[model samples]
Target: MRAVVFDQFGAPDVLHVATIDRPEPAADEVLVKVKAVAVNHVDTFIRSGGFRTNLATPHVAGRDLVGTVVAVGEHVQSWQVGDAVWANSLGYDGRMGATAEYVVVPAERAYPLPAGIDPIQLVASVHSAATATIVLQSVMQAQAGQRLLIEGAAGNVGRKLIQLGHQRGLTVVTTSAPRDFERCQALGSTQTVNYAAGFESHFQLADQRFDHIIDTSGKVALATNLGLLKQGGQVTLITAPKTNQFTFPVRQFYTRQQRISGFVISHATQDQLATAAQWLNHAFAAGLLLDDQVSVQPFEAAAACHAQLEQGQDHGQRLVLVPSK
Candidate 1:
């Protein structure tokens, strides 16, 4: 197996590909022949060592991949050879796999790719977007006919939120750069705002408060979003607001009866992934979740992809990576 490995993280240039032995499936695990892998913001954080987690030397950075089952351990029965699957590598205990030609899975973490879905595009959205759906469905308890606001509306999770929210009959509002307003609206965002332009006055004057909010953008403060939420309304914080940006504690969020909670997909149950995957496929089939906008690069260019990611600007929605041919 040829994989991209970095012992130490600093710059994208530090990543280098090397051929290593393919991992064998342990009991209760499945060995997969990798086809496609999706890059998430987590991958970027891991590569740059931006998170508080300390991973010891020699880390293979990637958290999601889609592939075919080449072999299954004796204890595995739900999956058989040749089944197509996508999985979430939640970085538990700094496990190594993905970003390779072949990898092993615990079987439970892998789900089959349904019919009528483009494998690559499905992989592009499913793994990370599951977190977004979980934020709405599991954590925030978004209900039908409610108005749901999604921050980072143009990013991976935001795109899924728009589609999944609409599927659940929730009105979707989103914040993105001005360039994505039309596209965001098309993605079922009933009202769209460009937060970079100036969110305070814009959202404040809208005269309407959201029933549920999914804050994927770290830019929105708990206090700011609390003001945008009606009493008893809920807000799911996917990214925590930076401490330096505020002097006083974001106290109103607790006293105002505004429900503010953070969503972590790693902590989700298997049932949660199954539920999210079903909705993702249904929405994609309905044209609410567009896959045509995603762009894929070869795995050799993982470093380059990280560079584009670090620069904080891109023209597309999802950027997938495939192990070199």
Candidate 2:
């Protein structure tokens, strides 16, 4: 099996396609013949030694994959050979990655691909959809009709949050560039505010306050958004710069019973991943979550793709790699 392997953490150049021994399924796992895998920022982060250091040498770094089951372990009765499946919890936490000719996945973590869904699009949506599902459904436990605000709404995860929030009957407001307002609205955002024009001013003018606020940009200051929350509201942070910091408004935060929490999809438990997979399958089948701007590249181009992503050259396009047979 030719897999993207990195012997030591460094630059994107450290990644290369190498023939490695194919893995066999454990008692609770299945062997998947790789079709397509999505390259994520976290993959580059781990590759560059910015996140998760104690990795085994020659690590593979793909988190989402859409593939066909080639074999199943003895205890795995739910799946069998030829089953089309997608998984998002790979390439992290000591697990072998999906950027290979073949990868092994725990049976419970492999989700059946929705009928008629494209493997490229399905692979692209898994990471973002799973993060959105965990954040909105599991972490926040958002209810229908609640007001929600999403920062950086034009990005992948932010867009997922808007679509899922709208589907669940929430009033979704988003902050993004003025050019993206229409795009966000088309994705189910009820309102879009120009972040450059100042979100605080827009909300103040509209007298808007949300039951929940999520900063997908990681650049939005918590103190600035706290005033935009309704009483007893909650704020969720999913992305941010490593050195970013803000002064806490302790008095107001406590007085209003406002709460702030953070979530990384990498930290999601097996059960949480399963829950996300179910929602993602339904969303894909309904044609509600699709990435129209995906760039399909050869599997061997992993290193160049990583460089493009790190250099901000991807232009918000989801990059999918198809393994060469």
Candidate 3:
């Protein structure tokens, strides 16, 4: 099978196509014929040698995939041959990834595609969106009628969070540029604030304090956003960037009984992954997902993808490795 392989990670050039032996599945695994896969921000971070401390070298580096089951191991009875599957790599250990023509996934990690869902775009949205949903629910314990703010609302996870929050009856507020304002509103965000000016002022305009804040933007220098939190509210930091320190308001509020937490979807239980998947499937089925904003690229253009994402204008999440038209 041909795969975009890398022995030493440093740059886009390091990722190239190579013909390696196809993998057979273990007794509890299935061999998937990869149809399409999406790149997570973590994929770029790992490739640039940023995550070298945790993951070793010489690894296949994709996190999410959509594929069809060609063969299932003898021990795999939950899924049969020819089932359409998507990757839920949360429980899998090490770097067994989905960046190849074929991937061997434990039966537990392959989720069956829901009925009537687009098999191609399903994988593109499900993996990242699911991770975001479960992490928010676990970290924020968000309830309906509470004001929830999502940073980076135009991005993949943030958009899904907005939709999920609205569906659950929460008052969803998100920050995005002018171009994305209409789209964010359509996704169920009750309020759209432009990040270019600053978020703190807008929060005050709304006459509200956030019950939960999920920061998806790596930018953490904004202090006013912290003031938006009321007493007993929580701020969940997916990226606890060193540059973004706890401001005076956060410190004062901490003394007054407030909590701050962090969450990542790198690890998930089978039940969590399955539940998240179901939630995403429902949202997509309801026409609430905005994955079509993405540009689907060819597999061979994998190297160029790095440069495209480096531009970082948030053109939406782009998926690669599906056969080009």
* Best-performing candidate as measured by lDDT: 2
Query: For candidate 2, lDDT tens digit of each residue in 93-157?
Result: 77788899999988888999989998888888888888998999988999999999999899999
For residues 1-325, write the lDDT of model 1, one tens digit per residue. Answer: 6887777768888777887778888898898888888776677777777754544234666768888999999999999999988787534345554788888888887887776667788777775568877787789888999999888888777887887887789989888888989978887888888777457577677688889877776777666777888878887767676663523235666666777687766567779877877776666666545554667788888888777777875455577889863
The candidate 1 region of ten consecutive residues with least summed lDDT is 241-250
Candidate 3 C-alpha lDDT tens digits along 82-154: 8988885721256466778888888987887776877667766765578677866666777889889888888
Model 2: lowest-lDDT 10 consecutive positions = 52-61
Q: RMSD, each candidate, Å? A: 3.0, 1.5, 2.6
Per TM-score, the best of the predicted structures is 2
Which residue pairs in model 1 clash with each other? Answer: none
Question: Which stretch of 10 consecutive residues in model 3 shows the poorest summed lDDT?
Answer: 51-60
lDDT of 2: 0.88
TM-scores of the models, in the order given: 0.86, 0.96, 0.89
Cα-based lDDT at residue 42, candidate 2: 89
The parts of candidate 2 lying over 4 Å away from their true place are 53-58
